[model samples]
Target: MRRARLTFGAFGAVTSIGGFVVALIAACGDDRGGFIQNERAFETEHEGGAPDAETCFLQCSLDGRSIIDSCTGGVVETCADDLACGAAKCQEPCAAAEADRSSNGCDFYFAMPRHYAPSIVSCFATFVVNASNKPATVSLELQGGELDVSRALFRAVPNSTDLEPLEGPIPPGESAILFVADWDPAKPRSVGERVDHTSCPTEAKPALEADFGNFRSGIGDAFRLKSNVPVGVTWMYPYGGAGTHYPTATLVLPVSAWAKEHVVVNGWEATLQGIPVTQIFAAEDDTEVTIIGTKTVSNGDGFTGAAAGIPAKMMLSKGQFAQIAQTEELTGSSVLSNKPTATVGGHECANVPTSAGACDTLAQQIPAFEQWGSEYVGVGYRPRTKNSDEIVWYRMVGGRDGTELEYDPVKPPAAPITLSAGELVLFSARSNDAFVVRSRDAEHPFYLGMHMSGGAGRPPKVPAYGGTGDPEFVNVVPTGQYMSSYSFYADSTFSEHSLVIVRKKTHGDFKDVWLECAGNLPDWKPIDNAGQYEYGRVDLSRQFGPGDSFGDKRCTTGLQRMRSEGAFSATLWGWGAYASYAYPGGMAFRKLVETPLTPVN
Candidate 1:
């Protein structure tokens, strides 16, 4: 399966026969205009043949037009006008190019969380270039569980023996970086301390040697990234110091768009800074999940409990993940799965309500529940100093058992809050106003979460407004999952980025969208209770490039391709001095499949 043949060069024009020898001596006294001008120059040289010589000039132009039509005895046809130009120039579709078979392959699943300190959990899997002209050959596979390279450890940066060829063709639009995996918590040491390998740091030295020896602590492990086309998978979790770093990254959705039900939650947790975990995997095999909420089960040790009440049932197997550490606030919790499953809520260093500062470890990767949405438009997060006050927590989960909500500045704790199906309710808004959550009963669909307001660093002065800021988690893209097109990637070391869009507010005003990027566009703004709801914000730190600025280069990292005419749903939000993250630049509506050519009638 290694064939690379590309050659094309054909140019011949030696027609200097002295003006075609006086027009072929006046067409040999006019033998039907020199046999129709040499049969129109042999059908223009078989119509510029050359695909392996066009099957030998289409069998010599169908045996020279069948020997000039049976010896031309009955020449009532000037060779039948070159037999329709030799069957339209030597016909040959090659059986539809050998029955075209399309599918340039592209499977995905990524997760690497686990390491709140001694540091080392790097994982890169970039692959931009959403083809506009081919050139993509990416391959990656690291299935889950059982890699026991005999009590392994980890590090991989340019070293490999197995992890299946990753770095690939990736040309067309450009973007490629595959250094998957590098977890060096100082190499399995707890005895006498000290197991140097140069103490693991030379910018994390040429990694690619993992071995958490069956790794599985706080649910963090799942890998799969096959690609031959359709790419764009991101991952990053660097910076593990000062209570285990605070850098984050996202944009890896493609388990064929996973979805088998999910409602999971986590956005406000800060006992002394964090604790709200969640992690569920399972791409097949047995699957059978089921985890209602309000946790409370301990001894069995699946990862402690108590996020609401209780309801658990398990059976994962395919790359298993399961981590669930709750402290009460999983928002109506529900996870039902039977096949596709992939969740990843956050917090192990939260502090959003504890006055946003200090603790930092928020995650994201939850978007199923049939893509929840009954209309949502909450935007919040823009106050690191301006008199400081940018908190906006709002959780709502109820897909049955009574559901009913309708807010729009109705400042509540009111309006039929009778949940049940998955039950969850939490709402807040410290002023940076912009809210809405309609859903009388759109078949009982409801799911909205948006928490952003966690200052960072100097906290502990604790009083009421809670220190100031550092907690982050953004997930509110449901206007029925708006997405008129998108192609994300933006977390260039966080220094403060933004992109909260959210749309829907026609006739009465508020529906003017725009956000191109790289080519530049940006200009949305419209949130202020102007009727149906519409919000905007952009800022992308000078337009792109940062996450180390795509060193190896390829599509130039400025990856953002948006579109609009109405439908909207962005959400990118990086953070400043203390680090932050948020993702989901689009969702719902997927249909791309067009690579079967062979019908040149």
Candidate 2:
């Protein structure tokens, strides 16, 4: 959608009439009289007989802007983007075009990090999970890199402990894990060498300026996964089993979800050298990205320079990407691009709680700023300790200024708080605790994310932050964007894996939600006393425990399926001795606004 405005003649503007100018700022500058939306009919002349999605959206935006232009207008800009709540009511299809961006897509871009890996270890995979009825055929290709390399790629069969080598395409309900690179391969592999991708490489070796282009797939190069069927994508780095792992993972949304703009977010602050990083990768050629709300970042490609809080631009070709890493957290940075592009935010390996001893890699493909939601139910992850609360970290990024935020049940101390555009609030949520976060209305959208800090730090150990798992990151799926069904996969490298589900209790078939292998969900508890939403957890790892492996083992590898009449959201989280990973089940990646799709994930 084009940037919209709601200028008013009488609201905070000086209109000159026959050499007589009247000052309205002092008389009408009291913040627009509470931002009320009154829908009125307007005749929109379209070329064809009826309005389609584009025409419908155009008319709706214009109708909203027209209404606000007649009102006090100083504060009613949020409604100009959508017809749903912005002064104009649109049809279901038109709203879907604007609101229902999901995860199904044909092309995806990913570049595993050169984490703060002090030592070397085997990196398990970057997975592509198929959710479609038809089989998913994929190609894991890299720019300027050899094809059909001697890599570790396997088709994971859900429900069973089967990691089948992928010589053929992914089955209808299966996923493939491609080991692109290992941290410390048996031997050093060159850019042209036929070996797997890199694990977390130490920043010293190859150095950020040089070796990154060789292996990091950033600035100069990138890895693109082209697929025949829409599939869900995720990546886990250095996923060694048990005590040998220190990992982080993120769910990759489809190209359809990519927008021309984004807001950057990252984990806690760390040492000057280990701060968070924001990545910008192109979906097509001739793409240009402009950044704002950021600190000075050394130009990765040397094509342009970046300065603090000033708009900076970067140009890219088809298979290229760039990064902006800083000691200062890169949260709230604005990303604007001419072509639809993907923006990923997180840390290569940073301290979770700002100065925590152990650090781990964090990565999550961020959603477009406009795709953010106003309501979310945050269900906590597995407790890091037995009989104790898990301290999960959550951050909220305001999409608009003057956002009045609230919480249900036990209102937080910071409840009824207000945030300006690009502002953020960070807080901790305990294990087994759930919070219903929201703003007053849909016009005040915000983004919420969950971060996991490793259990009590263990010093003198190889990977010190070694309690349950190192810091992990994943975006919280909004209740408004929930899906009725999901097909996903969990890496078996972890000692334990679980799914945290949040469902609207008001749904007619709330009790009909079903997990294929686990049968009906066992525990169902309300998130708050309002009883509007409920939370539950299913231990996928325990279901396949030592002795019970053969029981549900046939269908648990990469195609675990769940369905319900009412839409619901689920997060996949798994952890090893000191390693962990998490991401949303899946979402439909519909084109946002005038965004277009290029035929095919």
Strongest candidate by TM-score: 2
Per-model C-alpha lDDT, please?
0.45, 0.56
Residue runs of model 1 more than 4 Å from their true location after superposition: 1-167, 171-177, 184-234, 238-348, 355-360, 363-376, 379-449, 452-472, 475-484, 488-502, 505-564, 570-582, 586-601
How many clashes show up in model 1? 37
Summarize candidate 1's per-residue lDDT along 1-601 as a digit string, tens digits: 2222422211111011111100000000000110121122211111112222111111111111211111121222222321211221211111111111001114666665563432344433332323212455554455543221211112121111112223436544334445455545546755332321113223323234554432223333466655544444555554221122365555555665566666776655536655676777876678877676645422123444332345567676676677765455554467777687878777666765565466677777766665555556676755545585644566666656665555555444432445666666666765356766555434556667766555543344432333323556766765544533354555443455666666654223344454434322334454434344556565565323332122242222234545443445677766655556666653541211111111110
**Tens digits of lDDT, candidate 2, 9-96:** 2111111112211100101111101111232112222111212212112212211222232222232333322222211322222232
Q: TM-score of every model?
A: 0.27, 0.73
TM-score of 2: 0.73
Give candidate 2 misplaced runs (Cα > 4 Å): 1-100, 119-124, 144-146, 149-152, 182-218, 241-244, 413-416, 457-466, 506-511, 542-559, 589-601
